[model samples]
Target chain A: MNTNFTHHQSAHCENGVASNLLKFNGIDISEPMVFGIGSGLFFFYLPLLKVNQAPAISYRPMPGFIFNKAAKRLGITVKRIKFSSPEKAQIALENNLKNNIPTGLQVGVYNLTYFPDEYRFHFNAHNLVVYGKTDNTFLISDPVMENVTTLTEAELEKVRFAKGTLSPKGQMYYPTHLPSEINWESAIKKGIKNTCSDMLAPVPIVGVAAMRYLAKSIRKWPKSKGVKVANHYLAQMIRMQEEIGTGGGGFRFIYAAFLQEAAIILKNDKLKELSFEMTQIGDLWRDFALNASRVCKNRSNVEDVYNTLADQLLHLANLEEKFFKELKKAI
Target chain B: MKKEEIPQDESNLSKSNVKELCYATDENGNYTTGLSTGWEAKTIALESSINTINERIEEAKENIKSGKASPIVYFMELHRMDWPTLADYVGLWQWRVKRHVKPSVFKKLNNKILQKYADAFQISVDELINYKGA
Candidate 1:
């Protein structure tokens, strides 16, 4: 099984897989483009949904979301399948690779031998592409890696069906048909519109509103659960921001880069300006993480820091609110 | 986010470059990363997280050694889980999981329950019952 797929390291997993699949299919879409057209920017603070015993704070949408959504927006046809058992999944993937079709998979990072030990968590939504096999090893294009790597068929099997939340269950996807051309203008408009909608979504726990929601939850932690829990909660927030694979701020930067590209393609100066503004917001987010880390580090007092952190989030939400509004009107 | 900002360093992952990424701007406003060698921020975060994990594992070890909790509790903490997460994995109620955390109840856990836990921890029942994590 040899698909001879080219591997390119990417900032984020799913977006990288989407871009690589598109490139393999001759579409040549960049990762940022896929992330943008997919409307990959999102925020959801689910205090009830615990990850590592802390409230869930996700910077982006679920795995495979960007690929599925971007393919739709670009008029590309893609096939997605999930297997009930590891045997069937392996067989299907082997057949695809034999046919020279690279397959994208969602697998748990915990069991992937090639993953850096420090980076390996119980995360099960990580995405990578499997394109070839030799002897007992499967060649994998993990977008986060610098080069192609190999996973033994046995090793691959475990990660494919790894247990815990968001189990992949052998989920795999590939582009069945990528159109020869694209309507960039309409695509850009739709992408921007959807992103604007996401940032402005009315739900209290979604969009920029979620930041405020998370801040409120942070404030409650010190009062309700005590300082230690609050510290963990804050650390988790920073992890969600800086540690977990170029998270919230990183995605924002990627989107800003996309907007910069869109500005050029659509000849819209406003998008270029928006891109700059978004970068500044990304910087603001980095600052938020820095200060929040201070509180987590126990270098700063909780009462002294929580209010500042909460206010920072409210400020970010307000900036985002206005930015998205202007973005919709600009397009 | 620019192409120029992408890190030239593709060093292997270590605790120092644990959160390695392609872009990390510096104080000089230059886009660079310690991907090849190491960066102070990445080092700190990695060490802190590892320390936290270690401290928790030590606590769990003490809890087990004192006979206040079972090995299951230790493994759960080792797996970076809370009781609710372990409960979800084993399809047991939180109360039942809490009960099972105690050595008195754990000694009486049936093969089925032990198997559920072993499956969750991805270990043999014997290993689940006996092994202390390094």
Candidate 2:
């Protein structure tokens, strides 16, 4: 059975899935709008939590947070479930398809056959849509892919239950009810306000403080850890920022897009100016990634190189701090 | 970045015939979406991590040959897993998983434990037991 779902590629997976799923329900929202309404931009540096042997760093909030937050703000009722058994999960998904509901799923990326090999790490929490099923293959609408694809039953189950950190455990979600009227102005204001607070959060490991904390750690890494280990950590940090479906510059450009769209809807000229400033900050982040990659590739033992990178990060933190303060005032 | 400035440098995505979606500014300074083949900075970072994994795998292989580590160590590194992650996958205690990394302790493991490790690695018991680093 096919639900006649239209596929639209997006820069990030969660935003794509959220936007596509809402569109299927007749919301006609853009991916950046969904991301903005969801308050998806975030940064966290957890030194104690080890992912792939390096301190866990995330450019976005935990998976599913964006979709859930957006749904709640828009007064949409979404059904989410996690099945203990793969068989039950399959049955639930088939039921949704039979009812003409396009289902969103949280899956591990490592065993997703359609993904490019370079992108397939053990990272779980990748989101996709399963719209139809025939014979043994399920139609897949992966947001990051240029076009829709399919996955066999066995292949789907493997990734659903891919064992590791953040194992999906056969999780599936779908919007059951969308309100008749959504107050775009209020939602937009709330989203912008929350994002400003999140970025300027008081904690050291979260938001702008976390960025500065990471800068301090980067300066220490070369001296405390050897050059090889330091390089590996830098590689991990860059991978989290640039790779893994973050659009271009760690969701900065995407947020800027949201602001531009918000500026039109709210007709706030100040927002338009801040949107441009955000784009410049996104460019700065790309510059940091480029220079940091050079340090990793050169295996540079020079401590000054790391110091330069740290200064770049500190500069970014300062810019973000001022930008968020201005954003909060504009709203 | 400007729409025209989006990097299309050849990288793994280009080799795989995949283009990633990026948000860039049009000439009007408005945000627009564009497709990029890849970026060299991202490719380098990705390759560095993969290289680190491969280096660990090679070290694990050498340790297995010297009888200092078990075949499990090789497969763990091959799968890009560490002791804690593998233990989480196999539902074993951290210390037990560490014990299973020793050549002596691994050889004494029964089929039940071997089966668990095999399932975690997505390999058969026969392959897990008989793997000789080839």
Which number leads on lDDT? 2
State how far residue A231 of model 1 sits from its true place (Å): 1.5
Instruction: Put down candidate 2 lDDT per residue, B1-134, tens digits, no spaces.
Output: 99999999999989988888999999999999999999999999999998999899999888877778889999888877777668878999989999888778888999999999999888999998887665
Worst 10 residues of 1 chain B by lDDT: B31-40
lDDT per residue for candidate 1 within A1-331, as digits (tens), equals: 6886888777788888898888888887777788889898888899888787678888888777777788888998889898988899999999999899999999988888876676667788999999999998999898877678889989999889876778788898888886778987888778888888988999988898897888777667777877776777777677776554563364787787788778889999898888878878987887787677667666455475788888888899899999999998998
DockQ of each: 0.29, 0.79
- Model 2 CA deviation exceeding 4 Å by range: none
Per-residue lDDT for A25 in model 2?
Answer: 89
Leading candidate by TM-score = 2
Off by over 4 Å in 1: A247-250, B1-19, B23-47, B83-99, B110-116, B119-124, B131-134
Write model 1 residue lDDT over B53-132, tens digit each, in one string. 77899998988888788898788877777665577778888899898887889999899999999988889999988854
